[model samples]
Target: MILTLLDRLNRRRAWLRWGLLAAGLLVAFGLPWTLYPPVATDIVCWGLFAVAFDLLLGHAGLLSFGHAAFWGTSAYGTGLIAIHSGVPFYVAVLGGTAAAAMLALPIGYLAVRRSGIYFAMITLAFAQMVYFVTNQWRDVTGGENGLQGIPRTLPGFDLSNSFVFYYAALPVVLLGLLAAWRIVHSPFGRVLAAARENPARVRALGYPADHYKLVIFVISAFLAGLAGGLYAVNHGFASLQEVYWTTSGKVAMMTILGGIGTLWGSLVGAAAIVRLEDWLATAGFEATGLVTGVIFIAVVLIFRRGIWGTITHLLRARAVAPVPQIEPHLEHDHDELQPTPTN
Candidate 1:
């Protein structure tokens, strides 16, 4: 009976998850109509970027301070391809994503050898190298001015229209999010989580934790690249700002704010950060970063589990809470209780 009850509970949980996912997707699909197309696009792009980062920091237990390298590289790659070649947008995006993954291969190999802060510093150093190269290569990258006038031509779609472009981009972003979700729930994802909890134990089991880390790093970079490419196409521009260290920091903040390891939390975090920035900009708030920092501190202090994490924690707590026991005397007649005492 216990096993059957547990099985039924698991099935209910699975259904609930699927229902939530479908509802969320529906909301995402309808967002462009309700919100500005540009704003909606930003949410999707940044959300995907945050999810990618979470895959590394939340799942793999690796903090990389240089993800902007992949993000920026893919943006540039996609922009160059779109501007110089007659290829479709999807092809350019794929090419850019592949380029980022390739770049991650050697970087991850080296960075995986280190752990903790050392790993972060190594990644940051490499990212700085990438930034310097892009900045100095003025002829190719257009230097500070960056690349502009990138073509938005996609077959059978009017990408020139913001609404159309947003719809076009939404599916791709959803796929990326779904992929990340699958990664987090899969056997490999379980191994990655295990590696995060105890690298030595994973290594002792002959899993080669470093290899897992490297693979996850590459995968995360590829996803970041995909987001960047989509962003570039959406904006019709690619610039050094995308690859800057600040960009990396912003995405990191998103992951943290969204409750880290929870994949959907990344989207919530992205939306929160992006909307807050937009509102601040419109309100002529020059101290936006200061305000954002204060909010981050508050979140860390008051809700250490983060927004989504806190919500999930509360739900779980309620689910497992013990029921209050009633006194037997209250349920039985007073006379019956007296007779029982006599017996």
Candidate 2:
């Protein structure tokens, strides 16, 4: 009976996970009906971006403050290809992801040397350097004026329609999520997780810990770049703002708020942050900074496990706990019955 109950629970948990995934996809594809399609697209892009950062920060246990470099680089790369070279939208995005990964190689080499706060500072400095170059390089980056008039979608597709763009963005986000999930669950990912928990132990195991860190850094950058490219295509432009240190900080916050180690938590965090920002904008609240800061602190204090992480932990605990499956068998033998049988 205990085994039977356990099997039923395992099936239920599996079904629940699948159901949640289906619901998420459905909402991504259908949400444009109620909300402006662009908004949903933006949320998806940012969510993916945050998740990418979470890979390094949460899984790899490296906190970088310069992830905006990849984000802005991809946005600009794809936007330029779409606007100037007339490359296919998908191709442009691919180019952007590649560019970000290539850029991460050199940066990750040096940044991975340090750990904790110093590592973050190094990334921040590098990101600021990128921001400065973009702001100064008028010919390619258009200076502070930013890139404009990036063509959206393919020539045949009606990109202006929010629903169309939402659909277009959906697949990209899904692919990015899949890649991140694969990396986190793989054997190499296990090593990285070990490195995060104990770098010395990972190194003692004969793994070149720095190499693993670099690989994940590059992967994270690539995913982040993909999201940025999507953002550029969806928005029809890329800007200096993408490279700003604050952008990196924002992604960090999203990761933390969503539950750093939890993959989908980043998405939940991004949605909450974006929606809050939108509501504040609609309400003409000029003090959004104060409001957001307060919420960030509150969430950290109240939901340390993060919104998604906390809920997931609770569900997992419930799923794993044993359930009462059978009542005890009660036996009663009467002497009168025995005498009747003897007769």
**Which is the leading candidate under TM-score?**
1
The digit string of per-residue lDDT tens for model 2 on 134-189 reads 89989988988899988875777777876887887789889999999999999999
Model 2, residue 14: displacement in angstroms? 1.7
Superposed Cα deviation of residue 36, candidate 2 (Å) = 1.4
Question: For model 1, how does the per-residue alpha-carbon lDDT over 1-343 read when each residue is reduced to its tens digit?
Answer: 5567667767877887899888998889998888778888989999999999999999998999999999999999999988889699989998899999999999999999998899999999999999999999998889999988878878777789888899888888988988898999999999999999988889889998998999999999999999999999999999899889999999999889989898788898899898888889889999888988889889978988788888888876766434444467566567754655431
